[model samples]
Target chain A: MNDVLDVALRLVAVFVCFLVLPLVVGQTEHKVMAHMQGRLGPMYAGGFHGWAQLVADGVKFAQKEDVVPENADRRIFQLAPAVALLPYLLVLLAIPIGPSEGAVGQVVDAGVFFVLAVMGVGVLGSLMAGWASANKFSLLGGLRTAAQLLAYELPMLLAAASVAMAAGTVSLPGILNAFAWWWVPWQIVGALVFFTAGLAELQRPPFDMPVADSEIIFGAYTEYTGLRFALFLLAEYAGIVVLCGLTTVLFLGGWHGPFGGDGLGWVWTLLKTAVLAFVVIWLRVSYPRLREDQLQKLAWTTLVPLALAQIALTGIVKVAIQ
Target chain B: MREPTVVAADAADYFQTYSVVGVLAVVGVLFVAVAFSANRLLRPVVPTPEKLLTYECGVDPVGEGWAHTQVRYYVYAFLYVIFAVDSIFLFPWATVFAAPGYGATTLVEMFVFLGFLAVGLLYAYKKGVLAWT
Candidate 1:
């Protein structure tokens, strides 16, 4: 009984965090970023810093009519938005948000495993979204998104696995707790591999071959607009937050306080996660996305071989440390 | 150097953990309800046909929105799937190979696994599928 209810509540949280928070953040981020670039941001939407912009945007999207192309597959067309949104939402289930501190443990399952399994399934939805989209652009975009996911997931999994090995458990904070002693000083390579792989998985700059606006024309998101587009944007932001959170947990001693005590341990989780998230956003703002061939080569040739080596090294490290 | 909560927290060990997802879902419902209610009460309504047209690339008229795509892309995807699974086996075997005690067993197992990867690669090679111009 509790299991069912827990699932329901998690789903609801997924909607709120992944869906709602971003709507709020998007406006602030837009303003902050624009100011950084020496330009005006959305000032008229609400009072200070356009705080009410997302809410206003939400109302606009909700009141706006949902459009369907006359020739598009109606059933599939309708299903695509929800399908694209679900895997990302499923990601929230395993995504540890709070601190590597104990509080996050209460909210998640064996979070690392849960994250990999659920997050990996997101690609399936991307594949389905493309196949269902009758539009050629949308189709190509979807397929590319799926392919990109495949290319990145391999290395990301290896990196994540290495962390799991060091931690000796798949528990979110367990990975952090292992970091309690030098916080993965023994597994620096593993952390590096995971960071690179994670960037690709999140489809951020230099790895965003899936949605190269200059080339494939917004890729899988070629068809989305208004609230649906907003939903995808929200998922990406929340996913980034979760990605950084997981990384901080796995490598940065998570919620382990400065000297291995506890007080506002959750603050460390958020701060570290936020710092990593800032790096991602900074990278996005500062760099151009990776080219398709370059992206594929990094994944298949470089990262795959590197990840395999790391896996081997993990075994070697395990044998030696014992 | 002693635990603060360890002695006191033991009393709560047998207590049930709160439903994480349930708590989150309730939060989501409340958020949506508030947002929707606010929108209904606050936002002014202004509806007209001009506000509802399919806004294209700054163009008014165009033919129907359907186009044909090449079948080659789908073919490539199919090949990717077959190769991807075949590629996954190599790493596991590689990992198993490193441990000292399982040498001969690992070798035998890897060969058996390699047989499958070989078959797939061979099929792709012979069919001229791997060659991308």
Candidate 2:
């Protein structure tokens, strides 16, 4: 009974956090991007700094008509967003949100691989969404996303593999416990490769050709509307949170704050994640999206080789330490 | 100085970790279902024929929507398969590398393995598989 209650409570907390995250992340992105572009952002919705803009947007999204194209594969169209969004939520399970040892959802043995593998499945959603829409542009967008994701996933895995090599374990907390302050300096190249590959995997700016609105008319999401569209948006923000969390856990030394002891671990985790999230948003504001071919070329040639090299370097250093 | 806690020692104990994953998967699916159902209850469904048509910048879409995609995408998948094999080796290598007595010999062997993979990539590069048109 106690185990059931504990699991239920954890689920509730996870659900609540996932629910509230999109509103906060979306609003922050809007305000930050507005400031970067020197424009007023959301000053009206909730009076103070337009904090309730996302809430208003949520209400609006809910109330809009759910439109399905006549030619679309209706079954696949409805299922695509759910499939895409499902992985993000599952990816959360393998990750530790705070610094405490008990902060993780479960102490899975192959925790790192679990998280990355689940996250990789999200591309199926995009691919299905684009293909089912039955629009040329949507098909193009889906194809681009499929190819782009396939390319980037390799480097991302290699980068994570290097970290796994360094930490001597693939579990999240095990990785955390193995770390001191020096892990960053020792594996800075892995850190950079992971972050860069993560950015592309998340399909954020400079790698967002999957849904380049200018060329592909929102790509796979061209036909998605109302609640379905909201699900996709929610998934993207949830993805940002997951990527940032993974970055924190793997690279930044999860939950280890400079001043306080372990009590404030979640706070440090949150702070680091927020900074990474902000950097994700900042990159969105600053860089123009890469062309699809350019994006693929990057993953295949540059990141793949760099990540492989980092793994080799890590292996050498580990042997040298013995 | 603190000893790391072992998550599990046996198969039964390890399965407990997967139960948590199952719980998470349930919660995720439930969340989406309830939210969409709620929106369905609140939102109006006034679909017009025009709105139901494929969007094409205010113009009616001509011909069938499905079109031919670039062949370059196939090549990308081919490369992915190569790296997928490469990554499979990495996981085991990582586990074995930390074991006692598995020292420079193992490291050098892995590099030689990677050297072969690099040569494959170089071959692809020379063949212009990496080129973008």
DockQ of each candidate, alpha-carbon based: 0.13, 0.71
TM-score of chain A of each: 0.86, 0.97
lDDT of 1 by residue, A163-268 (tens): 6655556667555555655546666666777778778876778788777777666666665555555556666776676677677777776766665356667677
The 10-residue segment of model 2 chain B with minimum total lDDT is: B1-10
Q: What residue pairs clash in candidate 1, if any at all?
A: A9-B21, A9-B22, A10-B21, A12-B25, A13-B24, A101-A255, A141-A219, A141-A220, A179-A183
lDDT for model 2: 0.85
Superposed on the true chain A, the predicted chain A of model 2 yields a TM-score of 0.97
- Give the B-chain TM-score of model 1: 0.42
Residues A171-254, candidate 2, lDDT per residue (tens digit)?
Answer: 888888888887788778788878888888777898899889889889999999888998898889999988988989999987
Q: Record all residue pairs in model 2 with backbone atoms less than 3 Å apart, i.e. clashing.
A: none
RMSD of 1: 7.2
Docking quality tier of candidate 2?
Answer: medium
Q: Fraction of true contacts kept, per model? A: 0.07, 0.75
Task: Compute the lDDT of residue B63 as modeled in candidate 2.
Answer: 87
Top model by DockQ, which number? 2
Superposed model 1: Cα runs more than 4 Å off: A1-16, A19-21, A95-102, A105-110, B1-132
DockQ of 1: 0.13
